[model samples]
Target: MRDSFDPSASEIETTTAEEGKTRKRPRPGERRLQILQVLAEMLQNPKGERVTTAALAAKIQVSEAALYRHFASKAQMFEGLISFIEQTVFGLINQINQKEESGLAQARGILQMLLFFAEKNPGMTRVLLGDALLQEDDRLQERITQVLDRVETSLKQALRIAQTQGGTWANVSQDEVSIRAAMLMSYVLGRWHRFARSGFKKLPTEASDISLRILLSE
Candidate 1:
């Protein structure tokens, strides 16, 4: 029955975490977003040269120590980029799930989104393909692998439905449908990689309807 119950132990703990202690200020979630924005910008480079903390700091117009204030290490920054990639790509995939009536249409939408995402974010394409993550850390590459798996899984789901409807593909097993989905994903990645390597010149989906038909057929 004190003035404020002596600010209980839990309250004090929460206060310390919120306000920070001796090491450094807590990294705001928004700061993580900013760090990723900068990282994606770096990836747009065609040469895909190594991205150093110093260079990132310069691009962001902040000191390297400032970058560390939000991320523990440079590798964590790449992880941040991967997190954004997952959130964004999957969010679109979910929307297609809810919106599309035809499996073929959903498949088309997913491919369109993938290539369009690359076209919109040139720098992000480099990082997405691991041209930038190549020597940085193994974790970054693993994250990319997981991203591809999710996309492939979504594709298989849609294509399996398409086969059930007996359209372009008919009576496909999960295994065969899964293989076709993976192949489509591989095609998209190849297109994206070429776009990133060409410095965003070559597009992956200009005449994609015809190309997608070829993929859907074979």
Candidate 2:
């Protein structure tokens, strides 16, 4: 399993030397990625202030007009981050489903993956919990909510598999499977919220093993 998220080497900026002078320029699509990367880093601030375009542009050493050249608006930049979150997460979920045979084990793996992702990416944690989007566009928050709902759906599928496999959850009803999935989703979100709210001092995976054992136990 991947332990951390990082941009590809190709996405990083590079410099070219010409005529005794070195000039740094981002490759095609690199500046757009750099913008998103800086934004995520700024969000790591524990203060949790709304990230403004001015601050973002200043951090990137680019004018506001330059940022607009890559992204039409601040919301589009956020959408870029959100898209990263969705792709990284769902891609992993598909992997877990493919490798894990037991349904309960799948659920456990998914939950652990989520916590680990948040613990590793503090800035993205705020994005996951919607704290970073509080004052931003309502559509941004809505998109996050949709991502969360999809996560819950994945959990439900795993629980349903466990329920059918004749084990501790063999007798669990369909409705009960749904309820359990929701509870697990809530737990994951609560951990993320605490981690972000505490200025990243509180790790999401702190004591998660014991907690998951209890949560997954009959």
> Per-residue lDDT of 45-137 in model 2, one digit per residue for the tens?
999998999999999888999999999889999999899899999999999999998999999999999999999888899898888888788
How well is each residue in 80-177 modelled by candidate 1, as lDDT tens digits?
Answer: 77776788888888888789988888998898888888787777787777777887889889888888888988998899889877754776677888
Tell me the whole-model lDDT of each prediction, alpha carbons only. 0.77, 0.90
Local error of candidate 1 at residue 122 (angstroms): 1.5
Q: What is the lDDT of residue 84 in candidate 2?
A: 88
Top candidate, metric lDDT: 2
Off by over 4 Å in 1: 1-30
RMSD (Cα, Å) for all candidates, in order, is 10.4, 2.0
